[model samples]
Structures are given as structure tokens and as C-alpha cells.
Target: MAEALDQARAGRDAAGTALVAETRAVVAAAGAMSARFRSGGRLLAFGRNGGAADAAHVAVEFTHPVIVGKRALPALSLGEDPSTLPILGRPRDIVLGIRPAPDDLAVAREHGMLTVALTMGRRRPEADHVLPALSEDPLIAREIHVTMYHLLWELVHLFLEGETEA
Candidate 1:
């Protein structure tokens, strides 16, 4: 039991370290996403298997913000079929792929959409922004990804609020 606890603690520490290292990138991504939203662009997220759930969660967070009075942004989850990205995607859209295929991101880029990839450090997909997982364990990686996306959602709102105030 103690051994399991130690491993969990280590994973949490690793995730925090990785997030701290990528703080700049995360802020940049949120800024970019905010720009897209300001331009009337929608967020289109996609993933497969377990990642599909993550994608859906992202979409919900953006479309139905838990915070009261927060504006609901346009967002959608493509589920397992990213092939439709080429069809559903628009030039000003933001494509968020959670452990998605490289080809899917490439298509989004080709369509002039901004692409973001949440990777497990195994495969690097070409994207405007890439958030790589630090822990080798899948569970830890998922936890990191969840935290990253939550931060992104919050920061994007912050940028939008700043723009409105300005």
C-alpha cells in the first residue's frame, strides 16, 4: 500500500514539473484560442477510445461553462471520427486533438485552422501547439491532460475578459 502511494506521489510531482516547464506554451495556446473565439471560430475536439471522453469533456467545458454567467462558446467533439474534420472544420476554427492521429491534425492545418495536440510523449503530432505528457503511465498522463485543458479553458476566458474590458 505504501509503495502504491509513493508511486502516485511521484506521478503527481512529475506532472507538476512538466506543467511548470510548459507554462509558457500553455499560456500561448490559451491566447491563441481566445483570438480564434473572438474571430467567431469554434473549437472542434476529437479523440479515440479513452481520449474520446476527454475530447467530449473539453467541448462541454467550453460550451457549458460551470462558472455562472460565463459565456458559452461554440465547441464540438468529433468523437472517434476525425475524418470529418476536413468537412466540418472552418478556416477560423480551433482543432483540439487528444491523442489523435497525425493525419487528422494535418488536415486541420491544411484548412487554415489552428491545431492543438495533447500527446502522451510517444508520438509527436504536428500542431500549432503541442502539450506533451511527462509521465510514462497512462493514468498520470490523463490526469495531466485534464489539468492542462482545464487551465486552457480558464485562461482563454481570462483573455476574452481582458479584451472586453479593454
Candidate 2:
């Protein structure tokens, strides 16, 4: 029982520290994303299997903000549809790859879309922004991702309103 608590504490501490270190970058990314949104760009988030699930969560949260008085932003999930982005993507739009499959970032880059990749130490040069999960354990990675996306949602809104450090 104590071991579980220790592990949880360690995971949380590591995630918190990593996120703090990346706070400036996160805000910067959010600022750019907000600019795109203000210019009529939509956010396209996609992933496969577990990534797909995170994409769904991000889509709904961004499209239907739970916070009172927050504006609902335009966002959609690509799911498993390979044709979705090619059909609807614009240069001003943004793409987020949650544990994306091979070629995902390449495709988004080719379309000239702003690409944000949530990955675990995998260098993604095709992406404009790369946020690391910072954990090797799958469970820890999942928890960190949940926190990261939630922060992304909140920070995006804050950035849009000029209430953040962006």
C-alpha cells in the first residue's frame, strides 16, 4: 500500500516538474493556437486506439468548454478516418497528434497545418510543437497526458483572453 502511494507521488512529482519546466513553451504554443482559432482555424486532434480516446476527450472539451463564461472553440477529432483532414484541413488550422501513428505528422506538415505532437521523447521535427509525456510507465503516461490536455484546454482559453503568460 505504501509502495503504491510512493509511486503515485513520484509520478505526480515528476510530471509536475516537467510541466513547470515546459510552461513557457506550453503558453507559447497556446498563444499561436489561439491566434489560429481567432483567424477562423479549427483544431484537429487525432490518435489511434488509446490516442483516439484522448482525441475524443480533447475535441469535446475544446468544442464545449465546461467552464462557465468560456467561449466554445472549434475542434474536431479525426478518429480513424484517413480522409477527414485532407477533406477539411486548411493552412490556418492546427493538428494535434496524441501518440500519433507513423506518417501522421508528415501528412499534417504537408498540408501546412500547425502540428502539435504529444509524444514521449520521440523527436518529431515535422511538428511545430512537441509536448513530452515524461514518463515510461503507461499508467503514468496516461495520467500525465490527462493533466496535460486539461492544462492545454485551460491555457488555450486563457491565452485567447490574454489572461495568461502568453
Candidate 3:
């Protein structure tokens, strides 16, 4: 039990370090994302890794605003499949594709949408903003992505609400 706990702690520590490495990129991406939202663009998230949880998580967080007083933004999950995007996506919208398959990635680009990705490795060829997974362990990947997305949901407000760092 102690061994497992230690492993988990190490993984989390690594994930935090990885996130720190990506901090500047994340800030830039969030700035661009904030601009999109300001221009009446909505966020459309999709996952093709056999489940819709990632997309659902992103959509819900953006649409509902987990923090109090943050305005609810428009967002939707395109489900577990990728084909729906070509039909549903608009040029002004941003596509947050989670572990997208090649086909979905292609379709997303064809739609001319601003693309961001949360993935397990290097940025997929399709994602303009790619956040690589911090660890190879599946559990670590999940933990990192959840924390990353949640941080995104919270920090994005700073850009949108005109808050400056103290």
C-alpha cells in the first residue's frame, strides 16, 4: 500500500512539473481562446478514445462555470465520434479534440476551426494548441489531464475578465 501511494505521489509531482514547463504555452493558448470566446465563438470538445468523458468534462466546465460569478460560456460535446464535427462546427468555434484519431483530426482541420488538444504524447498533427500528457501511466495521464483542464477552466477567466496577475 505504501509503495502504491508513493508511486502515485511521484506521478503527481511529475505531472505538476510537466505542467509548469507548459505554463507559458498554456497562457498563450488561453489568451487566444479568450479572444475566440469574446468574438462570439463557442467551444466544441470531442474525444475519440472510446469514451465521451473528456469532452463532457470540458463542455460542462466551460458552459457551467465551476467557479462562482464566472459567466457561463457556450460549449458542447460532439460525442465519442468525430464525424459530427464537420457537420456541426463553425469557423468561429474552437475545437478541443481529446485523443482524436487521425480521421477526426483531419476533419477538424478541414472545418477551419481553431484547434486545441489534450493528448498523451506530442501534439497531434491537427491541434494548434497541444498539451502533452505529463506521464505515460494511464492513471497519471488522467490525473494530469483533469487537473490541466480544470486549471484551464479557472485561469481562462483571468483573461476574459481583464484580470492582471498580482
Candidate 4:
């Protein structure tokens, strides 16, 4: 039990340190994407089997504000609705392809939506920004998803707090 606890703490520490360094860069990138979306841009998120949850979580974080002190940002998850996807097949709208394609990423970039891809399979689209995650082990993948989102939420909260104060 003691060993397990220690290992967990170590993991948390590592994640935290890496996040502290990475958060500013991510926030800047996300903010740029958000700006484009504000000017009639949309968000397109795609993932394979494991990517589905990561895509969904990101969508939720942007669509609905989770941080207690931050405002909600506009975002969409293409994978969540099979029915709607059929109607909105265009790249301008959020579309989740079954597989990755170079064209897909290009379209997403062209349309001004930040492309977020989650995959454990052959690298496809080559998104403008790729957030690599565990492709194997379902449990580990879920943990990664949770940890990544927590970091994102914290960064967003910080940004929002500064904005409101200003």
C-alpha cells in the first residue's frame, strides 16, 4: 500500500511539473483557436476508439465551463452524434471521420477550427496540434484523459480570472 501511494504521488508530481511548463503554451494556442472560433470558427475533434473519450472531454470542457470561476467557451464534439454528423458532413461543421486523413486536417485548418485528434492507431491527419495520449490499456487511457483535462481546466481558469480582473 505504501509503495503504491508513493508511486501515485510521484506520478502526480511529474504530471504537475510538466503541466506547469506546458500550460502557458497550450493556453496561448487554445486562445488563438478560440479567437478564430469567435469570428465564426468552429472546433473539430476526432479520435479513434480510445480517442472518443478524449475528444468528448475536450468538447465538454470548451462547450460547458467546468471551472467554478471561469466563463464557458464555445466548442463542439463531432463524434458524439452519429445522427447529426450525417447531415453536417461538411468540414465547416464538426465532422468525425472514421479514420484519419490528410485532407481532413487540412479542411479543419482551412475552416479556422483548431483540430484536435486523439488516436492510438496509425497517425493520420497530422493535426495542427496533437495531444498524444496512451493508446493501449483502457484504464491508463482514461487516467490520462482525466489528468489532461484537469490541467486544461486549471489553465483556462487562470486565464479567465485574469481577464475578469482586468
Top candidate on TM-score is 1
Model 4 residue 64 lDDT score: 80
Each prediction's RMSD over C-alphas, in Å, is 2.0, 2.4, 2.7, 5.6
* lDDT (C-alpha) at residue 14 in model 2: 89
Every model's TM-score: 0.93, 0.86, 0.87, 0.56
| Span of 10 residues, lowest total lDDT, candidate 1 | 157-166
In model 2, which runs have C-alpha deviations exceeding 4 angstroms? Answer: 1-8, 80-83, 121-125, 163-165
lDDT on C-alpha atoms for all candidate structures: 0.89, 0.79, 0.77, 0.50
- Candidates ranked by TM-score: 1, 3, 2, 4
Q: In model 4, which regions exceed 4 Å deviation?
A: 1-25, 37-40, 80-104, 119-125, 134-138, 160-166
- Per-residue alpha-carbon lDDT of candidate 1 for residues 1-166, written as tens digits (9 for 90 to 100): 9999998998889777988899989999999999999999999998754799999999999999999978999999998778988889999999999887777799899899999988886678899999887777778889889999999999999999888411
**How well is each residue in 64-138 modelled by candidate 2, as lDDT tens digits?**
988899999999998755357777899999998887665777776788888887775443445788877776666
TM-score of 3: 0.87
User: How many backbone clashes can be found in candidate 2?
Assistant: 0
**Residue 82, candidate 4: how far off, in angstroms?**
9.9
The global Cα lDDT (0 to 1) of model 1 is: 0.89
Which candidate, 1 or 4, would have the higher lDDT against the true structure?
A: 1
- Give me the displacement of residue 66 in model 2, in angstroms: 0.9
Clashes by residue pair, model 3 = none
